[model samples]
Target: MQNTPENDHEQDAAPSKTRRKKDMHALQEIGEQLVELDPKKLNEFDLPEILLDAIHLARPMTKHGARRRQMQYIGRLMREVDMRPIQEKLDSWQQVSVHQTARLHQLERWRERLLTDEHALTEFAEKYPVADLQHLRLLIRNAHKEKAAEKPPKSFRLLFQALQATITEV
Candidate 1:
């Protein structure tokens, strides 16, 4: 007999995806609620919470628009977030960050020790690299003068395709 949808689903057609389906159903309900909510009801919710939740529930935006929008957000939030409490949190964060940085820096010095000691790399990568991990932070100071205004670099795939075209000509 030709199998029906019910029979196919029942015969362990791949491991069950019920959890994923449930999550999608819950998200659909949330999206329907957003469309259904009155502006006044949305306004009654905490402004920041509402903004964050609405953005989270919205469909993904185009990549270029999303990055520009995030930069705009950081600029706006930088102005509005309470400075002193934010500074205090940042200060604590800085201290923890510095401590972690120093610890990593010291461990990086010991990488050779890892090969000799056997447990060194395992313990380090598992916990934290014993090395300074200063990420490449950026700032476009005097952007108009420097002509270094910030934007994301082009996609690697595009770069590779361009390189391939240049290389293949006889």
Candidate 2:
């Protein structure tokens, strides 16, 4: 057969040995991450029982060589399963964690502002109309006294809880 553009295109389309190795290594890394996940979290993936058994089997192995081989076996098993949904779920879980962290930071900033600034309550009420302004004002006042007396920050914590409830409701 004569060399042709079509033949060259087919060759290019085929994954090279290096590419296959990289793909296998990536799958292996994902398998490792799966092994680290909690059993409950792992069940969410709905993996094949054989793969799940392999993962569960690997979970308790302390020997480095044995665990590595089990991981390789898991990777080999993973090759037969579609990874897109699993990867997507993992990514979404990460996104949820990031969102929760950001939300906590925002609530903390609000708590600080309310503690230090006189006008913060009014601003908070305006932003979150569902807030119990009277209750919050009382908590803030008590929180100030607690800070001055160096008491356990019960009111401060209550104030944060109030803010969380008020903010999350909206």
Candidate 3:
């Protein structure tokens, strides 16, 4: 016999414990993969062919061990690379225009609209009504609050109160 609507509702409301565990594991794997795609990894894959050919010459094997060994080599290189110094240098050498700051504020507001009001965010992030955008919502919400706090609020409360007082007196 097919499950009744009530039974189906319960089934969906309480997914098997195993299914939740599997989903959590899948999300963890995706997070790890994203963290591993560092700027150095991107550059290594995108560098000019001549430079790549030279690096390839130093490692003349197409063996499966190459990837494992190269990762270890990269880990070592990462320790020696001071990214903060480079970032500081870049920041010192570059300037942000007022337009860029305004654009950032606009992005912040969009993130807020997506977050505190999540049905819309889910549609945007997943392109489906059933999708969850909870994590993104939290991230954007916090950032939006921070950005809004940075700006002085426009003054309308006194004028609003004066108008209200006049109307009430009338």
Candidates in order have lDDT scores of 0.43, 0.94, 0.45
List TM-score per model, in order.
0.29, 0.84, 0.20
Give the Cα-based TM-score of candidate 1 against the true structure.
0.29
Best by lDDT: 2
Count of clashing pairs, candidate 1: 7
Q: Please state the error at residue 97 of candidate 2 in Å.
A: 1.7
- Residue-level lDDT tens digits of model 1 in 1-170: 78998888877656458865564454444333433455654453343664445444443445866644543443343343344453454456569979878765554444334324646435544454332222100111122223334434332223223323322331
User: Residue 72's C-alpha lDDT in candidate 3?
Assistant: 42
The superposed Cα distance between candidate 2 and the true structure at residue 29, in angstroms, equals 3.0
Ranking by lDDT: 2, 3, 1
Residue lDDT tens for model 2, 91-137: 89989999999999999999999999999988998999999999999
- How many angstroms is residue 144 displaced in model 3 relative to the true structure, after the best TM-score fit? 67
Count the clashes in each prediction: 7, 0, 0
Residue pairs clashing, model 3:
none
Q: Alpha-carbon error at 79 in model 3, in Å?
A: 30
Q: Which pairs in model 2 have colliding backbones? A: none
Residue-level lDDT tens digits of model 3 in 100-132: 566556545544455457575644544433333
